[model samples]
Target: MAFDATRAGADATELDVLIVGAGLSGVDAAYRLQTECPDKCYAIVEARDAIGGTWDLFRYPGIRSDSDMSTLGFPFEPWDSDVSIADGDTIRQYIQNTAAKYGIDEQIRFGHRVTDANWNSEQACWFVTCQTAAGEQLFRCRFLHVCSGYYNYEAGYTPAFANRDAFGGEIIHPQHWPENLDVAGKRVVVIGSGATAITLIPSLVKDGAQVTMLQRSPTYVVNLPRRDAIAGKLRQVLPKRVAGSVTRWKNILLSMYFYQYARRKPDSTREKILHFARQQLGDAVDADVHFSPSYKPWDQRMCIAPNGDLFRALRKGRASIVTDHIEGFEAEGVRTRSGELLEADIIVTATGLNLQLFGGAELRLDGQPVDTGKRLIYKGMMLDGVPNMAFAFGYTNASWTLKCDLTAQYVCRLLQRMDKRGEAVCIPERHEGVEADDMVDLDSGYIQRAKGFLPQQGTKAPWRVHQNYVMDLAVTRFTKLDDGTMRFQAAPSRSASPTQTATQAA
Candidate 1:
């Protein structure tokens, strides 16, 4: 395959596929593309200086995947460790190792940040604009695959606390934890009831800091073991790959069953969760006062307490949780709405993440700016009315990798189908009367706040998004590429003359 300049930008590098980001989804996409579509030429442009998108970015004291690693990790590679809840460093290494093993690392172009992707129907390719270390670089690809994780990597969401500057202590957000930040023998107050805040508390306590977690409201929390005994047992008996697949499916099924059960029977599920939560707390904190949540179970993500480490911290008097609203910041600490001052030598605002799509890159159709929020997602991968482009958005209620894995496979399937049919473009055209709804239906703060930026879903199949892995697996894997909704087009002009085609793309 050679570069095609006639149908693409004069200086643009032509590729069969262009992947944005070298994160989990990007790595997974590369694996699928190379294995399934061996003839296609592809490249991964990562904005960051290194691999492991989220894992490399967040370096908080106790950063770890909230979900079990069996599902969080790539489906092709088996997680070697017994630790279901893996630390950030280990996970980063795992992703890097996986990429290197599969030769996906060779496809990565670090420091190339894709800022814009414009579609040209005549060329049947996307002209992608990227900001690199030297300057701007352009790429033209028939298919654009966005594997960037959903979040603004530049910064995390931090609320404006009144008189925050008046505080005499060093303030930090989990997104940018400074090096040599010693919290030993100091009072530390971590604001927010989300997973980040919950994770940092136990770690801060271990660092010899007197930790106090301040939250405006209580969030549902549950404890899962750090290691999966069943996974370990399966590994010992079955072949490694077989064991990994089994462990992955076991966790996926359990997660699906639990979420559905909780949604269907919120009252009973709530009671059961609270009962187990209370047992973990065991009088270390008052359940009604500090642990009881206002929302039903599964409405928002439940805070995972790995091995009940957080509970142990509270019981041992190393850490405490305070449910209160921040009125203002004092010279020495945070002032509550009730006028109780929470004295702290250090404050960590683990508020939440700022949700972003497509790595903050702008999309255009025929030079007209496109709003994904107004469009519907197709098969939880491609966007409705968007041709030859796919973005990976993982399962909200389950492991992020589960949906991404299927999405990559779906893209490969679509590509193979397109090649076989001699189609240049494929777009899911929504029919009339397809009512719009939020793509991600979670009531979490991050999702709710970013509703205006996120895409919408329809009330029907192929357009309606399912958070369940089992449902998505069935639909994305087995569903025909040329479903009635998808409109496939071929450029007759390109087929005839001095123009761009898959063979011309390198």
Candidate 2:
């Protein structure tokens, strides 16, 4: 169990658990592993040089968490800020600070991109291949925890439009925003009506840019204050942790109720949301054309505007929304299908994200490849038939961390139970006759685009990923480890060390 550099090449390292990614989920997983499974050896492998996955990567005009920080933050670490909706930089700092506080930063291997992970039934371990600075490196671990988010980091989703080459203006995507590009006093057209577009419009307008959010269809937009007065008052009287817990549960219940209400009463929910948008925009913007989406509520993610910033921008004539289809790109700007030319000095494509699973790493069981799309998810964490592996995927309906925190806790409990039972391999087996469903039930553009590649869910417990956080919390946090689905076994006798084989190759 000690560092096995003697067997694998001197450069190779062996661990009890290998966590991929050093983002919020990864860091949270590390903290749980260190706390709950203190005897195990673990390391966090991050593709980027720095921590904070999505928060650190996005550096557009305005980047912030759509969900409140209380629920988004780890349950162990209480977010003490008065601002419920936190900015990107603050969130990034908080993640880094958490790592530092828990001594997790040292365990992170920066620039170690996991290219492939192969499970060896003979050794009961995962031989991970990583692309590092020198070349390909190897990491051997008993368990592989994938905390990498569900998006492609290399690029955002940008569709090819006709005559794109004719556009002479500067074009950019918020995912890869140029540091030196100037947008002051310029005409900017931000395409898409999702969260990125909502955040960017206000930020660009504040920076003196005449911004226009050009969307092909309408999306639900709701306004919330920047600071939560109730949270602030609770903090004044109650302890920080207690107040945080209260606020967290409050947000959780409210979100669950709203989502349920939206689903059960779609017409009323849509009307209420549109009414709020109309109040914010006044008579300046047409609510029916710009804010009323054709789909039912919760069909796609509802955009949250802090302090009514997006509406304020529109009211002040700093920003505007245009709902139309794009005909093509012209020399100066984009031409609409309605024959109106949108003059722009810079074009921002805030389309959507390209979804990726397990950081797009190739997975193989023994020598055979494992197709995740065909596999059933076990408790929303482990895939059926995948041994000693767990993925930290959060809720689509509620705050992401709520589910992730429970997943981390559940994994820790699993590792402990495995150790106690002297189990080397634990694989979730799919029972017969279970109905298969989409990995995520959401109809978002990104989710739909990657539906064919994602893992399938089931109709019953253990296999079903109930998007409800409360149900997930009860199941993931308190469920017995020896559930009928998860099968455990001892390690197979090996002739040679797996580490040595990998090291020699390295």
Candidate 3:
């Protein structure tokens, strides 16, 4: 049976759990809470006035899933679409439909941008403050689950060009693409060599625009088919549920094998990746010049070109790539440092995102501001010394939802354990013999820009944040909950642990 908080005349001000953000992670958190922890009351508070988080926010042309939909889609409700590399609209609709079908949408409070959350240790609850259109509003909950992704929503990172104002035509960032802007019959110069630039080149060409991607350096690129052949075959014979499970696992294993292979033997993996790019490009473009990367494979994410669409656009002379630093923007276009002038009618800055944690909401423990970066993440969900709080962050190598789903399920287990123990407060405490490291190993631009703002992961198990799904599955599902790290206190005895006040962070 579906849990409807609104229909039961429950107090919206109080809840068993409070989830922030309505994106992929938020929706997953809500569904898991409803089914697994049916007795617990919860509601979703979305910063935006919509359901889809990333898919709803990003409206750039040719925006699609970087990974296959089979692995990216929620496991319980599998993606049935034939197109494995789905477009943004399809994903947005899928999320919306899921929320409506499960009555999760009815539990949402739209336009509620969470600002601050202060723990009330006496009550073993969190008073979460939100900024809304009407003004500020506060809600209290036993557990605070933040599903907001780690990127800043209000602004994207854009380096200051020497003469940005001098550009005569329209200059745009893919983050806030203007709906009325037309790209057809225009010479568009896109800056950056990341995933956004790769996806945009092909789409811009299809809209009758000649695009040239300008980058300071090259990035590794791979092509995958637009549709899944195995998915087609499986669905033809098997039931929908069985087919989805098989296909999801198949894709997951293949991706895991490739990622591990890249990590172990980078030289072999790099050459193999180049071979595919060379075959796709032929003599149309110099693979060594445009596709070669400076860093090792998997050091940063490899850009995916669906169906070799970006390559096709380059091979047919519909688009091009320039590997050079920019002197600055000119009236006509961007000028390269090499004395080459590339003119364009429009400019698209596909630079990257600015990483933000908890949707820029400040967290506090007993009225003292908690420095999130100073704390080590326990099991990649809860932070050290943060009681009854969990966050959803996804994988860097594979599809995001795979890790997010596991995180939500683990959170549910923690809630159940608290109930079983008759405890009102539960927190993970950092112990000795554990060293801290960067939250993620990747050196991507977004990750690099957020050195001090991001949290750290431990070097040992229980505290270590591994990217492998199989290992995560073993730990989150099979491991015992009372592993000696998570501390639970009955309501009468609940107080900020004495150890928490002394050494609570990294």
Candidate 4:
């Protein structure tokens, strides 16, 4: 039931829920909302012309997930395929299929970009304004769920090259991959060593391009096959719940182990990681020029996928890694700090995305600017003073969908509680001492670069994002829905408990 955007007409449409961004988060939100509250009216407003937000946007040579499909994918819907790490196309199809199966496809309006949303304190609704291909449209909804994601819709990241304009080679960003661009038999230099750069290198190599990864620093590189043979075997006989739990634990423990190893024994961890990378790359390649990094393990992000595709590509001589800081861009190549000019016909900047709070839009409460920097994130979902609004941001280290699932479940519980109490809104208050800007703990390049643009964490419960799934389960899933902070004024009989202000309690 695909939505016929042109046929919807220009009438002011109202819904119970107005979701921004038809990406993974938004799609998941719709699914959860529809499944739990079947009678609720909801519409997904996508800025893009199609569904699949990041998957559709990123069309680089080898775009794929960093985590295993079993964990990275949605919780309710299982990826019933042989490939553990799925490509963008497959992932897109899965989302589309999920939307269709849940009867949510018709709910999405393509080319509908949200311009602004002003919370009406008196009306108790969000007045959303948007620009669509049809015309200017307005949507009024009780809940404004933002799933636009942190990354900029346009070109994500740009490297600081002294002579970017002077570079005669075709410059390209992974986000805006050219449609007519051909890299076959061309010397390709990919800058940045994040997921995109590593993923691109392996695929470009197969496409007959001599790929060289120009990375300023190194990341802890590890390999697993595309499929867990042990897990696959167990899944054949066991139920989905048991199998998923087992696989989840396996990945969780491995991730925790590596995270701990990188933190506690960085030197040994670096030696082991580099040694494995060298072994994978083989002796024919120059290990000194490529595998070494200036920083310790986990100082930057680590890239991993099943089957060692990137490393294998390097071993086959189809690709090479160059660890050097780019001094500037020359007419035909990039000049490194070591006084070496690496010639390239094509340059791909996989420098990552620019982080934005609430999808880079300034939130307004009753026509006044809501500073997210000053506010505290409540349970990684709601913001203080903002009623009936919740956002879902996945974990950086582990599978994204895992955290999203928890957030969704928590949101559902909150919604159910609100409904039971006959409450029109649910606003979690922010506590004091947690308003400081420097609470988040991740040190990724993107996080460091755009720390000011992101939201800060609270010192106490609900505000802190403990990456441990078990602990998060207790806080997000099993926690009591009736927290004293949430007010239900619409109810005839108000609770007798003393109400605490946003500053007094969390």
Q: TM-scores, in order shown?
A: 0.96, 0.95, 0.95, 0.90
Model 2: pairs clashing at backbone N, Cα or C within 3 Å: 9-503
Candidate 3: tens digits of C-alpha lDDT, residues 1-506: 33222332233376788999998889999999999988787889999999899999999999999999989898989899668999999999999999998999999999999998888766677878899999987777889999999899999999989999998998899999999678899999999999999989898999999899899999999998989999999999999989999999999999999999999999999999999999999899999999989889999998899889989999888898899999998998999999788899989999999999999999988778898879999888889999999999899999999999999999899888877777778889999889999998998988988988788999997889999999999999999888899888786553322222224432
Query: Per TM-score, what order, best first?
Result: 1, 2, 3, 4
Once fitted onto the true fold, the runs of candidate 3 whose alpha carbons sit more than 4 angstroms away are 1-12, 493-506
TM-score of 4: 0.90
Report, for every candidate in turn, its global Cα lDDT versus the true structure.
Answer: 0.88, 0.88, 0.89, 0.75
lDDT of candidate 1 vs native?
Answer: 0.88
Candidates sorted by lDDT, best first: 3, 2, 1, 4
Best by TM-score: 1
Indicate which candidate wins on lDDT.
3
Q: Estimate the TM-score for candidate 2.
A: 0.95
In model 2, where do residues sit more than 4 Å from their true spots?
Answer: 1-11, 494-506
Give the Å shift of residue 48 in candidate 1: 0.4
